[model samples]
Target: MKLYKVDAIVLRSREMRDADRILTLLSRQKGKIKAVAHGVNKPSSRKRGAVQPFCYSSFLLYRGRELDSVNQCEGIEAFSGLRADLDRISYASYLAELTDSASMEDQIDGEAFFLLLTILHLISRDGADVELLTRSFEIRLLDIAGLRPHLDNCVGCGVPVESETVGFSSSTGGVVCGRCSGIAGDVKFFPRGTVEILKLLLKWDLKKTERIKVPPRVRQQLRQIMQNYISYHLEKKLATALFLEKLYYHY
Candidate 1:
């Protein structure tokens, strides 16, 4: 077997028989990898805390025909703050789930990996608004996936969309002017301010995001729009997303 090393973020993990764990990692050089960590669950295991979810580590893996085996993993950053808070942990799970769903094995995406790590770090340390962060992540994820909707001009007319009431076409990939929106019966109208908010999210970095004030109602609307858009693109509802939504409402 050949040995390799890569920087990875733990996307998910499942317990195996005895003290082993099967980890689904999103790697910087390799898009996604499944590896077995023997004895990780044991109290004396050296890899105990290093293999936890949301952790960024440098892993030495031995390639196998069935699945890779983790020879060694040295913790780089555990993102401890995320694990300390329930809300942050839930949000991080949602982000990880989306990344895992969007990626394929053997594909390298350093940009996406960097984005996920940066967002995770922000959520961990910054007392940022979870809803806004979630929405921003959704938009940015779509943008990275090349699924970002057209916002500057009407999807149909190619004219600049300047109306206070704008129609968003998930199918068309952006805003459509009223004149052109009639062709799509399912298109939803959004306040211009909501449109502006979405644009701000797309343009700003995670740290600058806190400066923008979004009203509760506007935030709710944006949330619905992003959730619907993401679901339509992914073609399935995310389990972690549903859990996060429930947590949001319960708290």
Candidate 2:
């Protein structure tokens, strides 16, 4: 069998028979890959820490008939800081889960992979508001996935949406003007500022993101809108998302 080496981020892991694990990883060149790490769960195993969820590691994968086997792994950035706190850990899991759900095998998404690594690094080093970071990640993920909403113009009519109250059409993939919203069923209305905040979050980097503040109400609204958008496009609920929300709000 051929051996391949690449930089990868551990997206998720499931226990195998005993000490082994099935890892879902996102690699720089390979996109998403499912590999089994033999004997990784043992206390004395060298690969124990390397295969943990949210870890960025350099891996040597041996090709297998179905799934590749992770022969060797060396930690690049374990992102230990994210695991230091429950909130951070939960948020990191949410990001990893989203990436895993959105990505496909054999499709190289270098930009998305880099963005995920950068966001994890940022969360590890400089602490961010969990809510803001999660929302920002969701927006950026949608943008990267080519599902970014049309905030500047109406989805139905080709007019600039300048109304105080704007409506979003999940089916149409963006905001529709008050006039055009009537045609779309179950259209949700948002204050103009809310849409602007969503746009700003989409446009700015995490460093500059702190400059804008979203009120709790608006934040909640944006979260719901993003959740709807993601669910619509991905056509499934993110299992980790609810857990993160509960963890974030409960403690």
Candidate 3:
């Protein structure tokens, strides 16, 4: 059996055979891996804590004909702050799910790994606003994954947008000029501020976006727009996102 190591973050774990678990991990080198961790659920298990969702750890794995097996592991950053706060944990779960959904086994995605680690680092700290950081993360993730929205030009007409306000066409994959706005099924006009923030967030990291105070109205608009964009691309609603919305919006 061939043995190797992966620096990975645990995406999820499901119980199996009483004490073992099947783990979904997003690895720095392997992209995504499904590995079996034997005895992880037992009372005296050492890998129990390190195999849970959202744990960043180094995994010792052995190649198997069926699937990889976790030989041993050690925790790096458990994101302990996220565990104590319900809201932060919810958002962090969304990130983990998104990464799992977007990633593929044996496909190296350095950008996605770094972007996810960066967001987790920010969310685990105290200086960042969770909402803004989440929004920024959404934009940056898409950007790194090559799904970034076109902000400066029209998706339909191929013209430089000159309007102070414009409609975003999710179906068209970008902002639409007024002349091209009426043709898309999911087109909706956004005010100038919303458009500006959307443009700004695409290139900004957590450090650069941490201090910008977005007004409540614009923040809500950004969230709605991002949700729409994600739904259009990913074709599924994020459950943790809905939970986060309910926690914040009294829904």
Listed in order, each prediction's TM-score against the native is: 0.94, 0.95, 0.95
lDDT of 1 at 232: 79
Error of 3 at 114 (Å): 1.2
Candidate 3, which ten residues in sequence have the lowest lDDT sum? 202-211
Q: Clashes in model 2: which pairs?
A: none
Q: List, residue by residue over 79-164, the lDDT tens digit for candidate 3.
A: 99999988788889988887887677888887888888888888888866888888888888788777888888898878988787
Give lDDT tens digits, candidate 1, residues 1-251. Answer: 39999999999989987899999998998878999999999999999888999999999999999999999999999988888788889889999999888887778888788888888878887567766877888888788878887889998989999999999977667789989988676699999989889998987878777888988889877977787777878889999989977877542
Q: Which stretches of candidate 2 lie over 4 Å from their true place?
A: 249-251
| Pairwise TM-score winner, candidates 1 and 2 | 2
lDDT string, candidate 2, 72-122, tens digits? 999999988888788788888889999999988878899889989978877
lDDT, each prediction: 0.86, 0.87, 0.85
Q: How many clashes does the backbone of model 1 have?
A: 3
